[model samples]
Target: MNWLKSGFELSFRIRPVGIALAALYAITCWATWRLSVDQFFLPAGIRVAALLLCPPRLWPYLILGEYAYFAQMRYPMIEAYGLGWVILASACLMPAVALIIHLHRKAMEATTEGWLLSVAASAALVASALKLGLSHLLWPAPPSMPFYSNAALFVLGDYIAILTVAPLALLWMRRRSGYDWSVWRLPPTLAALCSLCVLGALIALVGAHDPMARALLQLLLVLPVIALTCMHGWRGAAVGVPLMNLMLSVTMPTTGLPSSFDQTTFFTQQIIAITSTALLALGSRITHHYHQQARPAMEVSQAIAFSRSAHLANERDLRERALGLRRIADDIEAALGETAHLLRANGHEGPATDLLRTFSSRSQQFRELTSRVYPTELEHAGLYVALQAGGLREAWDSSHRLVRPLLAGDPCQLSMGLQLAAYRLLAEAVLLLLEEEKGQILIRARCGRSGGQLGIVFTVALLDRHSTLTPATQGLAIERLSARANAYSGAVQCRTNRIRIMMRDTPLDSAWLAPPRDVSYSSETSARH
Candidate 1:
């Protein structure tokens, strides 16, 4: 028994492929059953044979099981009755059932419960009617017999059996194997199983105690089972549907069986089967709707998680960079003081004193700029003033042709970190153009309301030849700009020859602008020429 269980477990572990194959086997068994008990049992033997021999080509065997079942039962019966008439009838019925199942399977994949229910229900109704019509026309025997009461009875019995037995068997084989549908089939197997169970249970409940009460109960059961399948997966439905059906069957009345050829009783069964099928489809549709909605919510949650992780990583990198800047500032400040003292003590005359004075002043300025870029000082004052203090805009206005604040509105309300980022981006852009010997660089900074959000646009355009700027220059500026923008929940991008930076509206903390500690650094040996 343990070995048998282990083997079964292995078979089910193949996921959707296993589930799909099991469903195919179930279909073949049912088709075989249509012929005779032996025909039904034969497919089971064939399944095992394929399992041992050519597992990869198991689908052909499954299809062949259907063919074999029909050839043995329906075809032979037709031949024994009258070759022309029987063959024609079997040809019509067998193909029709096969086609119905195929179409139903496709519909089930696309729609969920609705299409499944529709296909199953319609098949039950149509097949039941056809069976009764065929029996009366060709193989009719005694009236008042339970099996021959009417077309409705035939429809009811077949519908009940397929809806109940097929779903249970399929769900069992699929769930016991513990498989996910992702590996093989397109549609979710759990979803299909849920739909089946819900319909089965519904029929079992509603039809309880009635002559075809079992069929009604199964139909009713499928409604909720489909819903449960959507939530808990097909496994729940697989277990639930069959359990409910068995319960209903055990509880169902066995008082007076209807005669097989009684048209009224048969027709009544058909009505119940058809109605149940329709209801199941409706329930399945509702389940599918919920599934569709769930996917987007899941995607949104994943995207948010990714964004948060990225932000945290960026913050870590920036924090490390800030620490480095702090050390550089301290060194530069010490260097500036030393340079000033050297000039004074050496009794340096005009030219030497002047040069030392200039170097000392610039060194102090560079220290200030570094602090603004790396610390919360810029974060406090916001981007506009940070640039002004950093000498980014002042430097541009002094050395270049255009440095202008395009639109002045309420000072942007944003975090100090964002302001620092914006300041650095502008500084980088201006510096790149200077390297190209570009005479005119238009730097425009604006803050205002747009799209119900605070909008900030910083643009730099070269007045000189567009080709003057190298790719390396543009790329560096963009990298710096983008780094800053992303930190603030904004983005920076370059289009054509212009860089565009935008920031969304956010509340600003007024205290952020308060003066903060400055990092002084040594830069005498490293000073640029």
Candidate 2:
């Protein structure tokens, strides 16, 4: 069963499991025969599906299974036609059909959207056409078997059979494990099956012989299929189509089916084939959309991974280096301070004062060197304090550029990762403004809990006092700010010279530590400056 299982490519070869394969094919032939009605030839579908799913080697086993089935169930009919008639039909029918499908086998197995549907249609055509010709080879057909209608009926039946069965076959073969099924009530599959049972019983007993009533019942059958398609995508159609076919088959007696071909039944078969194909295609599109939407989460992870992992570890290393540098600087400063006191004690006041000034400046320079690596002040003082009291504010203020600070909420709510991101965002915004050299940059930041998530909103408004800071310049700066904002899954909005950004942390106390999203900046890498 596993070797002959769905998705196992069948090749032409002699295998030890010939008997078991023969048995499997025989069972398949028998089941398809039982399910088929006039113009709904399921056996043709099975033959084609087996060809497509299995390898060429196992095809001989299928042929043997077909012969066994014909001998076991169809021998009586062949006996009436005599040995010569039997031999001709048996040799020509399935073997010819198999050979034809094998020839176009590569085309049907293509990666196109048609997939099994194409196989079903092609196989049904070849099988039905071959069977029709073989049916007339030995003798004239019965009076009841009119040629044109019978030919049309034969092809439609096989085509319908494939549409109904092949999807279910493909679904089983590619079924994924750990699928999240609804835990409440009955599972959708069992529920759908039970619904079909009840529907079949109602249609059979309702005595709706009129066209209007029958039409209503048929419409009822289609609604469930649409509903299932919506609920589970193409997978839903795979399950629902087979069930509808079963119901339509069960209630077929009311309309006198399995009797002969007529206008109503022929049209009904065509409609079923067309609609089922449409639904399966639509379902595939829906499945693709859902997968596309989930990819952003993966994008978000990749974007922030380097920042959180390497950058943060690098920050720690810088801090340690800073401490070592500061210790060395402090020792020299202490030595200078001691030496300055001795000189002043020895009546050299001017020399002692200059040395004291040199040591003080050298210590501050060491702090500046360390800050370049990891913003050491930002670590100890947090974001608002770093912006308000640190060298960032002092440097610009000394250059006659004003940075007006407006900060709110508890800074402690943000994790170290987010706090660092906020500092970078603010620092970069100020740097852009400072480049203009003539604008008042109003820096505004607020940290607060929004529902479950703690978040920060940072806005920098450029109060331009010159014609040089044009609209284009503000747009370019906004673009840079947005790149950083977007990488953290934040929302960015700009109006005039003001750009506002909102980024959230995970709910509860820990910051939203999900990795940075790389996709956000994919389109705006030029703005990273």
Prediction 1 TM-score vs. true: 0.41
Q: Residue 500 in model 1: shift from native, Å? A: 30
| Total clashing pairs in model 2 | 17
Q: What is the C-alpha lDDT profile of model 2 across 100-143, one tens digit per residue?
A: 66676575443333456656666667665655565555444432
Quote the positional error of residue 10 for candidate 1 in Å: 37
Q: Pick the candidate with the highest lDDT.
A: 2
Q: lDDT of all predictions, in order shown?
A: 0.49, 0.64
Model 2 vs. true fold: TM: 0.69
Give a tens-digit lDDT track for model 1, residues 283-351.
Answer: 455546756998798675555445434644554477577668767767866776677677667876565
